[model samples]
Target: MIDHPPFALFIRGSKVDAFAVSDQLGFETGMEALAVSLFEDGPETMHVQALFETQAQAEACLDGLKFPSDMESFITQLPDEDWISKSQAGLPPVKAGRFWLYGTHDADNIPSNVPFPIEINAGLAFGTGHHGTTKGCLLIFDKLLESGFKPKRVLDLGCGAGVLAIAAAKALQQDILATDIDQDAVDVTLQNALANNVSEFVKSYQADGFDSPELKGQRFDLIFANILAKPLMGLAPDIAHALAPDGKVILSGILNEQAEMVSDAFTKKGLEVSPQPSLSGWTSLLGQKP
Candidate 1:
């Protein structure tokens, strides 16, 4: 595939099988893919669209996918004009606390009296603020706030668009450090923070796991990590060490079964994993160092 700035791929096939294939490929290989399963205007046939960064990457991944003998698929690159126009369209609004998150297109329309409004245009970033993992963490964070729980310092690991950091900064009005492995994500996070006028309260950095030299030996009253199971496990030590006594930790983006392994890693480091809350088969684990 040509090295297009913002590439997109479309795949249509047996919707269920296509989703399964897409998910397997994503989790196993960390491919850039998004599966959309839908029924057309009528239910005669199911449809699946798997978006990818490059036509050749999508094709190569699909070539190795093990589908049933009868399963079928068609792949093509979306026209540049269509892709650009569609991507430039409005994004659905996201809300947590009194904050409202809008994309660039919608930010201009937000009312001035609102408590907070942030333009979180992710561009080609992996997170778009629509995933269940993200929404679940927001819900749990809401519950914590409703109960009047407050933490002084906050950190968002694998911050993506920095939604979690933005949420924490809005809630605590404290210094928030949001870090991601991808520089694009760091830029997106900073842009979102500025749009919300929390650029002073929330800082963005490009860091993965414990590789962030600035975070070394630092401690926070709260930490939110919404990464996958493997990295979550690998960072258990850093997470535990960086947390203050009685610090609260929130984690997501892993399934129920995988939670045990992740929880165990943290537990061995003296953090106690609380019960998990389930959403669409994925699990969010809460822990505290006490």
Candidate 2:
């Protein structure tokens, strides 16, 4: 038997275009982990990194690529350390209103005062409740729950890691459609849901923003979308169409400067937008279909 060590691949470019490219690659590549971020101390530089199961896999994937002229690439052996566990261990538990989110590494550390505790481990996908956008969405979900809103039909669009969907399922004890454009994200969501013991309430699928036949005729009383600004604006009509009468929609992943544009798109679709508190420059909006 032979052991194959994993490899780490990275590319660097400007954040604006590089981030988008990195995101597309992340969705399509099925890497163990992929991330795009601005390089600290160098605001203009962006980094896109991916981890592959083997060096051969990484090289083969990169060989078939059409990287931009300015994009520089690097491949190296991934360290033997348990990076995932170590990374998850560093994230402190976060409280969003009544909900307390902690990774499995700190499961035993959950406070006694926290009423709703969600266990989310760091995985190949997003939404560990660390990102501002995710936190904002969680806060919106908490507020909705506190308001006595019981949505029997729920949809979590672009539900990376399925945190929002899991939260809704646990809170409402109802079926939830968790869809993501990436199949890997769908798998990760299912895994996370099972880990949180909410798998019975959550179902996942790979769909490009309501394109799946599974979602075509179905309407949801509550829809949660914690995706980017452009996609959120573009999907406004689809979201509105899929929403049941008097239904609620929670929108996050909009930068502070882009919130107005996103809000206007949904508002024009007959949704009355209610602003939620911003966290770390991200805005979360709650809307009601009238």
Candidate 3:
């Protein structure tokens, strides 16, 4: 009478993860869990399982399993190796034909154009055009361009892989500064900038969260940040501090349910929040400082 989603890690079950399991449990031997079989044996008595975030959590759940000693002989772990994938595994377009956004691996397929093709080689970082939240930001920013907001300067925060930064540079005629807490992401963004020929337009920096001394007293005509909800709330002061009066901002990477919370954070700092459509369940926000 329980629906337990086992906390599972994605390792080929019988291999390292099994070894890790035995080591973690202080057991002399380890056996991988065999897949459930629904055969003509008897009743389809199901084994209980649940997902735990860590090994400790998994062990705790294991402690609750009530496997009768008589039934233990029927269970066994199968080999974890798997190779049942289709040809479409690497076929690009995590979600197809939506204006070619380059988030995760986006730099590899940079968008092309006459004005300029802002190539961005994104890696394991978040906030490429592929993620729903990032794509939502791009859509709104496109509208900003359509509305004739000619920005001379732009700033992108939490610039994972600098995808948004590159897009703003190419879309708005260059002149961008992108920052991220992770140095690897910064490196990837610069590489993408160089690839897309927007190197001149984009600059990069590294900081913890958003309170770097390097960015103090700086303001921009356009600002973009696609970070998650909680940190974005904490960043209200810094965001407001960096945006120019009368400038506009495009914020994303928040769920629709939490949009109001993020909006309130900015509203208290004098940034006017307006609703942009949700991409998937995440919210995109637009605001202006007058």
Model number with the top TM-score: 2
Error of 2 at 30 (Å): 4.1
* Candidate 1: tens digits of C-alpha lDDT, residues 164-262: 888888778878999887776687778877877788898888775665685877888888898777778888888999999989889987766677888
lDDT of 2 by residue, 210-265 (tens): 76787888899999998888888999999999999999999987777788999999
- Candidate 3 has its poorest 10 consecutive residues by lDDT at 33-42
The TM-score that candidate 1 achieves is: 0.72
> Which of the predicted structures, 1 or 3, would earn the higher lDDT when compared with the native?
1
**Root-mean-square deviation (CA) per prediction:** 5.9, 3.3, 12.3
Query: For each candidate, what TM-score against the reference?
Result: 0.72, 0.85, 0.64
**Pairs that clash in candidate 1:** none
Better of 1 and 3 by TM-score: 1
Better by lDDT, candidate 2 or 1: 2
lDDT of each: 0.69, 0.79, 0.59
Cα-based lDDT at residue 83, candidate 3: 12
* Candidate 1 lDDT score at position 226: 86
